[model samples]
Target: MLGEPSYTMNDLFAQLGLDSSDEAIDAFIEENKLSKDEKLVEADVWSEKQCMFLQEEWKKDAAWAIVIDELNVRMHPTA
Candidate 1:
């Protein structure tokens, strides 16, 4: 039997209304990276709606927060 569905980078992308494919996710991360001082929700790469979602999920430590934090780390490689 299958356990709970796991949330991953692809899931997070889909939640944000982005291309959720592996290739698209890789290309997007490569193309849009955050500087050491930049916050994930404040980055120019996200739309206002996307930013709000991220911020709310993170603040609430919701189920999506884990994947969201992972994305933040990946986006801030310089940090």
Candidate 2:
């Protein structure tokens, strides 16, 4: 039986319409990192498209929500 995954960082990149290459993913992670001083939902860093995708997935609260939420935390690992 299939189950929801704890998506890898590359999986997140692909899902988020980004280059899934290791270098690109690494660069994206480095570039989009929220400071230990900032928060994810409050940050204004995401592009319009990125924000839309995240908001839609979050509203659905379905298949991608867990993965998306995980990605959210990874993107903002602070208060």
Candidate 3:
């Protein structure tokens, strides 16, 4: 008997209403369980490649500032 079909990165992106951008893709990968190398190949699901790319790209962008600001707000509601 045939089993269920697997999902590719393209398939996932469509389902999540996300583009192949670094940020969106990375978030999805992190939420799911995929690896960088794994993503390169045709897998049954998303891969960590998105996360890895984001980790490096985020370090070079202002995203860290936003994260820090959010954390501060959460920690110091009155501040």
Candidate 4:
């Protein structure tokens, strides 16, 4: 039997329908730092669909959760 596919930041970005290139991901992270009180799913940087996808995946603790949590941490440097 095969294990479930692992995900990365690039895959998460692509799933979110955003630019998935390393440089683009880096640029996006640098540009979108969130304050400690800010929430990743509620960030203005995402479209409504993007927000829903993130929130749903996170709530479900799906396979994408690891990458999503990674993104949340990167975005909230103050946290």
- The most accurate candidate by TM-score is 4
Candidate number that wins on lDDT, 2 or 4: 4
lDDT against the true structure, per candidate, is 0.91, 0.70, 0.43, 0.93
lDDT of 1 by residue, 1-79 (tens): 1564568999999989999999999999899998999998999999999999999989988778899999999999897
**Winner by lDDT:** 4
Sorted on lDDT, best first, the list reads: 4, 1, 2, 3
Instruction: Summarize candidate 4's per-residue lDDT along 16-77 as a digit string, tens digits.
Output: 99999999999999999999999999899999999999999999888899999999999998
Instruction: Return the lDDT, model 1, position 62.
Output: 78
Better model by lDDT: candidate 2 vs candidate 3: 2
lDDT of 2 by residue, 1-79 (tens): 1785556667766876889898986676667878777645456866788777777867888666777777667766463
Candidate 2: give the clashing pairs: none
TM-scores, one per candidate: 0.90, 0.62, 0.24, 0.94
> Roughly what TM-score does model 1 have, to 2 decimal places?
0.90
Worst 10 residues of 4 by lDDT: 1-10
Candidate 4 residue pairs in clash (backbone atoms < 3 Å): none
